[model samples]
Target: MFSTYLFFFLSTVALISAVMVLLSKKPIHGVLYLTLTFFTLAGHYILLNAQFLAVVHIIVYAGAIMVLFLFTVMLLNLNIEGEFQKSTLMKFVAAIAGGMLFLVLIGTLKSFDVATVGNPELTQIGLVKNLGKTLYSEYLMPFELSSILFLSAMVGAVMLGKTTKK
Candidate 1:
């Protein structure tokens, strides 16, 4: 009973924050809403007993990624007054595309077999030890490549920040 209420509360907050992220005019407000959405998602992960994922989600997304997003927005100095208004035709096209995507998602979800419960024994798959083993074994190459990519991105950012001599 408590779990159901908690799930509903979290889901409502997540959905509301997600919508606010899209509807917010200010970039900062949007970023804040996105962070709220991330927090609610992490709560959902915790409720599902995926504590490792919840921690990672809070750290990587709510902590690091949101900071990056806010920094980028500030660096760009975006303002509502400076932005151009979207054309009516562009808005119509976007609405139609969004509706189509929503329909497709609903169809995909409906096709899933809801009667089957996942194996209870497999719940430990989300534990840190299991995750570390999988990451170091099956996904080692991809992980290393991602680290290298991040390193290159940092180097590029540093190079871009350097002043050019006349």
Candidate 2:
């Protein structure tokens, strides 16, 4: 019961922050709101017993990605004077489209079956130990291949980044 309430609390905060990310006038405020949304998502992952995922979510999204976003926003020097103003007709159309999307989402949620998604008892699949074991034992070949692929991609990126003499 308590977990359910906590889940709802985190979900509500996430939704609000996500909306704020879209509604915020300043780019920096939107980035901050996006970070808050990511934190709430990490909270939800923790509530779901996916601690590893939660930590990664915070590290990758709230930490690295948010920093990159903030730097970009700062460097861009966004201001309202250069902002493109939306026409009244465009705003009305956007509102109607948003309303329709919201109705579709509500209908989808109403039709979702809770019983089909029940959590299994004593599940530890999301834990780092189990994940490492599975990755190293069962999916070792694909994992190693992906690592090599990523390494090659990094090398290619470095080569491209190097300036060639004219």
Candidate 3:
């Protein structure tokens, strides 16, 4: 009963913050809303007992990604409200695409069934070793690739932000 209540509360917060992120006028405010959304999402992940995912979500999205967004917003010195108006055609197309994407995602998640295993008491060896093993073994390539991607993105953003003249 409490779990269901907590789930609904957190989910509502997440959804509302997500909408605010989209509807916000200022990019900085939008980034703040997105950060809140990520925080509430991490809370939901914790409620679901996915501790690793919760921590990783916080670290990646709320901590690192949001900081990068804030830095970009500050660096860009963007003003002038960025033309808040959208054309009707663009809205219609966006609505259609969003609906299709939602349907596809629902269909994909229909196969998911949450079945909890008996709570095996996790020891010190459970977390760090397990995570390290997966990171170094199964996902090593993708992990290395992600590091390279992040490095390249940092370099690219620096290059783009630099002013040049002929």
Taking all chains together, each candidate's TM-score versus the true structure is 0.83, 0.79, 0.71
Instruction: Please tell me which predicted candidate would have the highest lDDT against the true structure.
Output: 1
Clashing pairs in model 3, backbone N/Cα/C closer than 3 A: none
Residue 33: error of model 2 in Å? 0.4
lDDT of 1 at 1: 77
Candidate scoring better on TM-score of 2 and 3: 2
| Ten-residue region with minimum lDDT total, candidate 1 | 78-87
Candidate 3 residue lDDT tens string, 103-166: 9999888898768676433333335466678779999999999999999999998899798986
Which segments of model 1 are wrong by more than 4 Å? Answer: 112-115, 119-122
Candidate 3 achieves a global lDDT of: 0.83
lDDT of 3 at 17: 90
Q: Candidate 2 has what TM-score? A: 0.79
Cα-based lDDT at residue 23, candidate 1: 72
- Candidate 1 per-residue lDDT, tens place, 50-149, comes to 7789999999999999998998888888745426668889978998999999999999989986786785335888788988899999999999999999
Root mean square deviation (Cα) for candidate 1: 2.5
The lDDT of each candidate is 0.88, 0.84, 0.83
TM-score result, candidate 3: 0.71
* Candidate 2 deviation (Cα RMSD): 3.1
> Which model, 1 or 3, shows the larger lDDT?
1
